[model samples]
Target chain A: MNAPVPGTPEHFIANAKDRVFFAFDRSDLDESAVKTLMGQTAWLKTYPNTKVTVEGHADERGTREYNLALGERRANAVKQFLKAQGIADARVKVISYGKERPAVIGSNEYAWAQNRRAVTVVAK
Target chain B: MIKVLSRAWGRLGAALFAVALGVAGFSGAARAELRIDITRGNVDPIPIAIPAFGGGDEQSSRVGADLAGVLQADLERSGLFRGIDPRAFIQSFASMQVQPRFPDWQAINAQGLVQGRAEVQADGRLRVEFRLWDVFSTQQLKAQAYVTEPGNWRRIAHIIADAVYERLTGESGYFDTRIVYIAENGPATKRIKRLAIMDQDGANHRFLTDGADLVLTPRFSPSLQEITYMSYYNGVPRVYLYNIDSGKRERLGDFPGMTFAPRFSPDGNRVIMSMARGGSSDIYTMDLRTLERRRLTNTPAIDTSPSYSPDSQRIAFNSDRGGNQQLYVMNADGSGVRRISHGAGLYATPVWSPRGDYIAFTKIAQGRFFIGVMKPDGTGERLLSDGYLVEGPTWAPNGRVLMYFRQTPSDSRGRGGDSYLYSIDLTGYNERRVVTPVQASDPAWSPLIP
Candidate 1:
């Protein structure tokens, strides 16, 4: 895996600021999503010293605690994929946001689709 | 012979119904006497009237009505008051705010009266001022004012209910407390468990974590703010303490094993938990202040679900050391271990009642789950109710009632199982279901607010 240079457009595009989403109530990654995540994995491998945090989130349709666990599963799913793409496991930290911070406000399915997501942020 | 048997069964059913009615009447009188001991004058949930707060325009009148509706619901749910209908008001707030017509309220058998005024301030904040009066005594009980966003009107109503509950019960109220539980979604085989917190009345619901790892058995601190729970984070089951006010958490210990069923001490200075090092689990206590860990029980058998007495002088827990699981009590420092329960069942989750009078426990007998209570000495054992799977008894602040979870069996398809929170009086009369958005379990009640 070739490491992308920091401060490059590729780096910004591959980082967490772009954000990633999941299917409804699912933590598995599809082939296209996996391929896109691999590009970010290459960038993370290039910057060995930089740490990243994965925040898991869920839609507002379920109970608060179960959504928390679902958020955690989503974040862990992303973390596992990143590890498989040549990024060291130690660099990834996961947290479950549950349904607390929803990206959309409505109670409909469209809003929930946006809420069910995980975002990678620079930890250090 | 079959006809004779049918006649005997019919007689038995009629006899049971008569006995039930007689028992109900007797228990009703007993409850009235008990209330006199706990609260003077039979308290009978003082009848009070809340008039629409004056000074609101047509639009603000609607808001006031909404606010009053919320307050009425809160007070009624506490089982502590009868809110008089506003339509029965003979005097308007404009004429009563300065000096209420005591005789008018007295005629309606109202013992207390609440009058208030609401206004939308220039800055868009809602300002509300209210006064509570003892109608019979013609004395003022409480007077206060608050300012908050319009969206927080429900919280303001709860604050008022708390004040009213405190003044009447002579004990702090639980209206301000929050409940943390496992929120469940999806099918039984692949259920997602998340950590969620909400007000006692099921408002302001928020999730603390995503369903990435399994979490269970959340216990609140004495302050009713912090939470300690068992989580399988990092692929290891361990105890973790979280600050509810601030989103910060720390792993409890670095033991090379699994930890589960963590609870805070009465004084909030230590955490008592069950740690499984090998195949056996023992009870351990860790001082949150000193970070010093001590083993409370060193047995080779399972000793789990440890709860500290209110005074922190004794601990009640469940152990299978003596064959089947039974209730046991020990000194706080781990001495004087003694078995308390001699019932005909396996008892798990022995929770010490907050009033220091009884121990609430979950019993598995005859392939059914039952919640029961007994004296600290293990006598006067009484089972409250039976269910398919009922566990985790948490005490109401006054210790007069208990709340627990009941999980119903799934259908033939095995895909529609559900669990809910339920509360029952200690005497086991008022059994009611608490409403939640989804499946809730492992409820822990907080102390009454001061």
Candidate 2:
């Protein structure tokens, strides 16, 4: 498979690979999550017509309702940080699945570390 | 509540039995007394015998056996009474109008005996008359009757069980109530959940909502007709009130951001919920009549899961403003904020017991979940039950037992796992699984049905 052309939608989406991670019961972005968000902002700026939904999630460590609120804060944190970095707020839609949707599904710390993340999905 | 009325003959027989037992002096009064001390919720259940009822036609006789079975189950489930195996009975209950052979019951060590008669009246209504007896003293403890349509036999059984339970334990019975919880299906990633309700004994299970959108955190109103819950119906999480009888749905308010973790006020007049705005969540209360919204917690941290005290004067909730999730208490008007949980673990979902003696909560410590209770002032914390995932502690109407959900871990792919509801005594002695039709979570016990 040939590499997609630079600055194409495919290229920008490929650059938006890494998802942000959060500590337990926290929605604030850590240094690593902030760095990942900073990298995504570059690709978000290149594709002006690109719209994305910030899907927020939590580990299966807390109550469902509180995890939902935490997910919302995480998603909004990503959206706001992107908006602050010159991305359009309208282009960044946010939805919190709480701990309802997990990227990894186990009860261990490793699974939880992967599950507690915010992923930026490119809207069709 | 129907007051027990002992007929003249029953009263005379009880008096005679009391006099007969009086020969032993000290053992006389205590043995004749029907009440059982349930303070520690006696793990060794009292042995009781409930023989099949008599005086019914063919169909009525079948129902009589069923009624006795249900009564037996209710008493057994309370963890206060154990129904002795009928095969050990030396004397069968051939007629309710006649007294039981006390020597025969004593031979089997049966402390209590319940006998009843069922008859079809001229109007086709079933008339149920039952008598509870202290077997050792042969004293009639309670005698009550009910007349209802034959089709409503289970309710009659429950009513009889309640009477028997009240007479024996001196506490109100919880067998007549219902439990509302989330019935979950599909997989962990794309799970479908519906609001489901069932009888307290896991009978007559029915779904209240279709699994079209995600729903969570169901709570019963002080009145059992309506339910307040959080639903993501329109792609936005918000508090919704569902009328079970009318099949009507109404959004509590048009909040700009997500609203969740809803609970009805003790008086069922207002709803307290948590709403997220500007990257933070806070607690708020909205009156159902005027739709007037009042902000309860102004914290930048997540403050959710607000529960009103039985008196409706104070509120107990969980907040993370203290750097991690911990329980807090505040006035109903959100005044005099103070932290109640100074424990080592994260505390969440603090539900005030109906009796107002203790506050139940979910705690996470050292990679496990625990359902625990503490006084309102946060001292005397006791972890009732713990597991891989046990949460959402809801008190029975009498506040003597707590029901919560437990989940076992699935495989790495999140398949082959199961969740169930469990109930534990307030004194943390008896813990048993509450059967659900499907995987269940977030149970809310209804107040006793009128």
**Which candidate ranks first by lDDT, i.e. highest?**
2
* Residue-wise C-alpha lDDT for candidate 1, range B399-421, written one tens digit per residue: 87688888775543544357898
On DockQ, the leading prediction is: 2
Model 2 segments more than 4 A misplaced: A1-12, B1-32
* lDDT of each candidate versus the true structure: 0.72, 0.84
TM-score of each: 0.67, 0.92
Q: Identify the candidate with maximal TM-score.
A: 2
**Second chain alone, TM-score for each candidate:** 0.83, 0.92
What lDDT tens digits, residue by residue, belong to model 2 across residues B37-100?
7776545889999887655578778888888898899889888889999999998666765778
* Chain A TM-score for each of the predictions: 0.82, 0.90
lDDT of 1 by residue, A89-118 (tens): 778777666665666655456766777888
Clashes of 2: 0
TM-score for the first chain in candidate 1 comes to 0.82
lDDT measured at residue B341 in model 1 versus the true structure, 0 to 100: 92
Question: What DockQ results do all the predictions give, each relative to the true complex?
Answer: 0.02, 0.65
